[model samples]
Target chain A: MIEANTPLLRMVRYFWPMVVLCIGLLIIVAAVDSTGDIILAQTLTEGLVRMVMVVALYMFIGNSGIISFGHIAFVLIGAYATAWQTCCPYTRDMFMPGLPTYLLNNSHHVVLAVFLAGLLAAFVALIAGFAIMRLSGIAASIGTFAFFMALYAAYGRWSTWTSGGSTVSPMEETTTPWSALAYAVVTIVAAFFYARSRWGLALRATRDDEIASKAAGVNVFGQRLLSFVITAFFCGMAGGLYAHFVAAITVDSFYLKMVFITLSMLVVGGMQSLTGAVVGVVVLSVVIDVLRRLEAGIGSFSLPTSSAEVGVGLIMLLILLFRPSGITGNAEIYWPFKGDISSSGAMKRQS
Target chain B: MDYAIQTIISALSLGSFYALGALGIGLLFSVLRLINFAHGDFITVGAYALIVPSSAVTATLLIGDFHPALLVLCIVGIVVMLAILSYFVVFQHAQKSSPATMMIISFALGYTLQNIIVMIYGGRPKAAGIWSDLTGQVQISSGVSVQLLQLVTIAVTWILLIALVLFLKRTRVGIQMRAAAEDFRMARMLGVNGKNVIALAFILSGGLAGIMSLLFVTQTGVLKFSMGVPIMLFFFIATVIGGMGSLVGSVVGGYSVGIVSVILSAILPEELRGFRDTCVFILVIIVLLARPQGLVLTKAAKERV
Candidate 1:
């Protein structure tokens, strides 16, 4: 490993490549926006939201090595949090009479709504994590899944607050591409820093060997809980962005479909690194966009749209079969010209 | 008294369904350490096997037109074959991977299978009128009645459970599977064929799924591509709550979930009925918190450091 003078320097060295990639992606999306492609702009914005969510997922799952299915539950909570604050007064009055007067009468700014959404989700995670973090292995996974199921059921039925499983529509569509990109960058930087923090290293140590970490005075449960809450905050923000981007939200949107896609992206990217999460989202998004365009009939050689989903599933399976560690295989891509930080050397260190 | 009797009977029927599904999942987990997400798709495949593939609103009976006994055997055989094929084709290749990876692969397989069914039959729910004669009510005692189908379901589940216990106790293959479940690496070193035992478990699991599909279709009289998911979810929860690797624990867990579900539905007000499942899930979390290893802890459930 290359010696660094300080922890900050070491973190920068470890994560600069990921930061460069996020910036590059944002610039490309911004360029596309200048061309006045609304559909492409919206797709990129939605993709950025997903990127934030997946990276947030990587924060907890990568460091702790626990497969959590309940993170999407935070997304649901976040979306509804924004929905309560940002929905138009008339719609709020008509459907959500249970809301407090401050939220129901006056629509809040999107930025504040998104912030509160993350805060609310983080609060929920803090409460739930205490009970959930005590368990380990597959038992913890099942517990999180149960938590997800319960949240889904409760949200789907709590009609006065959540519109009782029906679609709550026409929220203020204020999440432009630039705003989403900003959040995505913030999420990426936060995750990168968190992963290099003392808590993050302790969690990874515990993940690698729980008993040894405990012997080394690492509070495994506390570290995992911290990661869980932090990740939930970002995921919740992504959820708020998704609600505003789509201009409508529903309970069903945050169910199995979201869970499968996000988890697949994270796993396919290699669940062990920040680089893997970002690369997985960007790569899968491009492939999906291509397949969707093909399915919609490009030129005269058109295929059915259903085939796109099949192709995605097939490709994911093949990837898992051949390279289970994912395309990046837990290695970060460093700049080649930076001779002090060799890419292959980083790979060797990680492996 | 009558309401209590009706609830008890309903609980038994529901418990039986969960028990069978849990056993299938538990058996696979015992040997493979895989929580097979595709197990639900196997049930769906079994249900669909009864009807010819078409995009119609109602399904046309394929094997359902056969004699009931032959129909059950044919469906079970087809499902078992499918299970074995999946093991060899997909899971066997990923045998050395982590449990999380294997779980995702199973999810992928399940998604692929569901999509294939959707392609063949369209996404609409179809009416599957199988054994319509069994829908009649049978009076069990004074002022109490139960569906004939429920009675049959209960009988079938118990019979299968007893038969399985006998098979495990008396047969060489069954004993070998138990040994592998106890300690797979040790069993392999002690002259047991790992592949053969695992294949046997898959067959038995698939057979259980097949039976569950038939019973479930007959009970609901409708077939949808996703009908198996709810059952699979409950079965998964049951397997965990019963103790992950123990067959007997799976049964007890199933009954516990079933009883809780039945009582909640019976006692909850009309408006709160939809939240019954949520309550059951919360109960599961509490149980998990109380005993993370599960209520029926097996020796194998302990982590080997």
Candidate 2:
């Protein structure tokens, strides 16, 4: 084991190494689609945004040790929030015609718009969490799933507010490739920080033993609510970024399929570890990308493939049957290449 | 007044199916502490079984002339068998893991089964006939007509529920199942095979779902590919409101949801018709928060916090 003390040794733990790896991965992704062409850049941007979205989901599933099938609702909200801001007043007014004139005219500034969307998502979560976080285990899971279904029904029917599934367009003004990339990077960093924070530790403790945690004065309900709210914020942010990047939003994007995809990624990466989250996202993303390409290549030939649902279902089954605790199992990945130089002689001996 | 009677008949009929479905869910929860998310899918599976001609076996048993009851029993038998097989294969393995694992696996199984249904029979909805297309309407007064199927559904549901209660109370196996549900380890020590008991719970749940499907499709005259989610929600809400482990609670919960939905659909403004789901969810939330143990007798905790 590397000695705990020493200047150089301290600099190179699991945390910084993971950070470097993240940055390196980002650089590589940036290099692949750095060109300014709209279509190619858009695809690349979409992929990155998808990655961040999946990772944010991973953070929730990883840290909370509970299942959330309703998180996509927040994404839907964020997407609509951004869409409402970016689209021209006439278009927004045409879809959601009751908008006040001044409010419709003043919709600009993507940054503030996205932030507001996140806040709204969090607010919704706060209200929903009060109900959802009361139960534990499978009850909580079912409760959240029910909440999503209710919200889905409401969103579909609330035509006065969401314009009844009609595409609100011309959101192109709200997006810049650079901003999307920046958001993705910041989210990943934030996820990392949240994973190691005190709340994270308390959550793990709760997961490990709820009775003991309660005895230790940890309020299980409160912790779960806080975690859920944080997760909703990131999910909303991802949604806002996606809305701007895609130039539109639809209710379908936040359906059961999206929820399943996020759950599958969390399971594959190792539900218990941050490294597992990263790995799961990368692997699932690659699989999805390859499938898209293959489907495109096949063109007229329909492969009878049951969409992405099959992949997610298969992966979740395999992980549950094989690795119940997941790949990381509450441990962060430590690379040996980042040598322990703090003890001096040990580093020298290793070299 | 005619509309009121129609609505009441419709509500009671709908409640019958919901009661059957919720009982299935509640039984599994009580017996095994397993929330089979696939409970709704089992209902869908049963509907498909009734629809697909190739998978079905035709038999004519002449007691008087022909007994459709025997044929229905056969179909329910098939459903129970399939449910047993699925539980033995998927959930049995999850017995050693956390509750979350079982939930995920059940969900995965549900998804797979849904896709498989789509593959075998295309994603289009199928219409099932529990009763004949021939209609017998009770013309209560003038324009309002309550269909024969509505009455049949209510009768069948209550009969099945009575049978279930009798089976639970009167039979040795039923007693053992109940004992296992109360405390699996203690029941096991007393010589009840916990595994078999759990599997039995699943079989009973699936069989009930199949019966509900038959009644539901007969009433609606059409079944859709995506019918599982809404029905599942109905079952879940009923189970939650009535309490998970209590049979009487499941029945009460089903009636409560059916009555409330029917009332709301009628009295609710035209503009708020779409918000029926919102109301249902809000109601469930309020119920859960008020009585987390549910609206019945105190039982074991639903989930470990």
Candidate 3:
């Protein structure tokens, strides 16, 4: 256990494997795109999305031990913020009648706008955390869901500011194949730092037992709030990337369906481990895409055609029934850094 | 004066729907410690069953002129089928899981049921004759015309409430259910069949939801794929405000939510009407902060798990 938390242990964790995975995925993407196939490009896009989302899930639930139904709210806030800033000054001037004049004039520079979008999402989440983190257990879970509903209702009805639920599209700058790869790499690295941080340890202690942790002088509320804000930041970044990835966004894209899908990814990945989040998101997203393709073939074969949503739901149910603790439990796989160590020693050190 | 009476009458009719939904939810919560987010979908399934079969019967009558008695029997048959299906599939399965897991799974089941309905029938709203533009409203004064549907809704809900009270107090199974809900382990040690008692609770809750479905479809003359979600939220609020395990609490919670919503819409700006949900949540928070237990719980029942 002493060896596990050593600075040397931290330095090598994900250092080589992350680099290798990114390079491998990039080559695979490049090879497929070179074949002049649109499907290849689409697959690459899905790959990037899955990777980033998986990392975000790891940061939010895997590390923090808090289930959030409203993470999609940050996604919407970030997507719209970015789209509103990069779609062209004239287009913004015409459609968004009430946007600040400064924003209208600065509707270029996609990178800067996206950065701002992520920051804005983090700020909003910070505010929400103040009230919501006050709750614990089922009350906290219910409160967060209500937060999602409240935001959804507001986003739908307050259309004057958000073009009244119109799809914001044609952002001048878009995510290219290379940039998506870069974002994925950054996502994995950020997730590593987040999970190993002192704050992360505090959050985990709170999750295991609140009364004992409070007795140990941990600021339970502060740790939870900080984690919530950080998680929302990544979700916001993912939203920004998504906005630019497709050059279009809709309110419904960030609603309950997406929330459920995100949750399924996190759960299937293994709720307790970072590797599970990454594995679950990548595997499920690809599986879903493949199922969508099979829909047509299945229909021709006379089997009842099922939608992606149903397929995912079934997977979620099966996983729960069989492995309620999820695939990885709470263990993160850090290959090449597993110096000889006893498992019980690790457990004792954690306590 | 006429408009005032008409609005009050309409509100009261709508309040009955809220009351019915909340009452069932409250009953299940008292017994099972589960929220049954799928409860509203049960209502949706019941409405679809009643409306679809009744329409088929009405069309058959128009074509072959079937007996009116057969038509009535078919309607009853549809409602019974829906209630039984609700018990067998959702609530019964959910009883095995913990409260937290059940809440999540119930939500999953809800979306699954809703989407299956969409796949079969699409996302369009369906209505029945009771909610349709039937004529002949009784005018209490010059302009206060109350529709027959409104009267029927109120009368039926009141009768159901009375019968429910009598059944719970008088029946053997009902006594067993109350005993189990208070302390599951204790009741089991005393030889109560906990499984059978919980199953009965699901049946009663689902049946009450079925009755509400019939009334609501008639009153609004519309049913949409998404109506269940919002109504479910309001029902949850009602259950919480009324108290978790108290039958009377459910009734009071239902009426309170309905009346508060209507009054807020009337008094607040049109923009702020949406804030009523937020207000309800805030009210629950306040109740938790002050009492932790509900408004109407007994001393024995107040020590909630």
Among these predicted structures, which one has the highest DockQ?
A: 1
The DockQ figures for the candidates are 0.65, 0.46, 0.31
Badly placed stretches (over 4 Å) of model 2 are A1-9, A34-47, A173-181, A291-302, A338-351, B51-74, B126-136, B140-144, B302-305
Q: Across residues A1-351, which tens digit of lDDT does each residue of candidate 2 receive?
A: 454455655656535635764776677566655655665556556656666666677666666667777788888888787766766556677777655666567786878888888888989999999988987766677678778878877887878667776666667644554566677677777777776678876776777777999899888999889888987887887788888776766777678767777777777777766566666766777676665555455667644445455655777777788776665554455545545445333222110
Among the numbered candidates, top TM-score falls to 1
**Candidate 3 residue-wise lDDT, A1-351, digit = tens:** 735566665554435445545566678667876887776576677567656766776676665566776788888888888877777456876656678878777765777877788888889889887888877665566657767766766666565556656777676436765677777778777876666678878888888878888999999999988888887777787788888877767777787777777777777767766666666776787778777677656655532344555677767766655565556554555354345545333421222
- In model 2, what lDDT does residue A33 have? 56
Model 1 C-alpha lDDT per residue in residues B1-305, reported as the tens digit of each score: 99888889989999988989899989988888888988999999999999998878778999989999999999999999999999998888888877767787888888778877887788889988789989899888888998999989899999999999999989988888888888888999999999998889999999999988898888888889888788889998888888888899899988888888998888899989989989988877888889877778777778888
Q: Give per-residue CA lDDT, model 1, range A139-232, as digits (tens).
A: 7777788999999999999888988867888887888888888998898888777876788889989889999999999998999899999999
After superposing candidate 1, which stretches have Cα over 4 Å from the reference? A1-15, A341-351, B269-271
Compose the digit string of candidate 2's lDDT tens values, residues B110-218.
7877766665556665545455642478776788988888888889898888898899899988998888777777899999988778887887887898787666666
Query: Which one wins by DockQ: 2 or 3?
Result: 2
Q: Give the residue spans of candidate 3 off by over 4 A.
A: A1-36, A43-47, A50-54, A176-178, A302-306, A334-339, A343-351, B1-4, B51-98, B123-137, B220-223, B244-246, B271-305
What is the descending TM-score order?
1, 2, 3
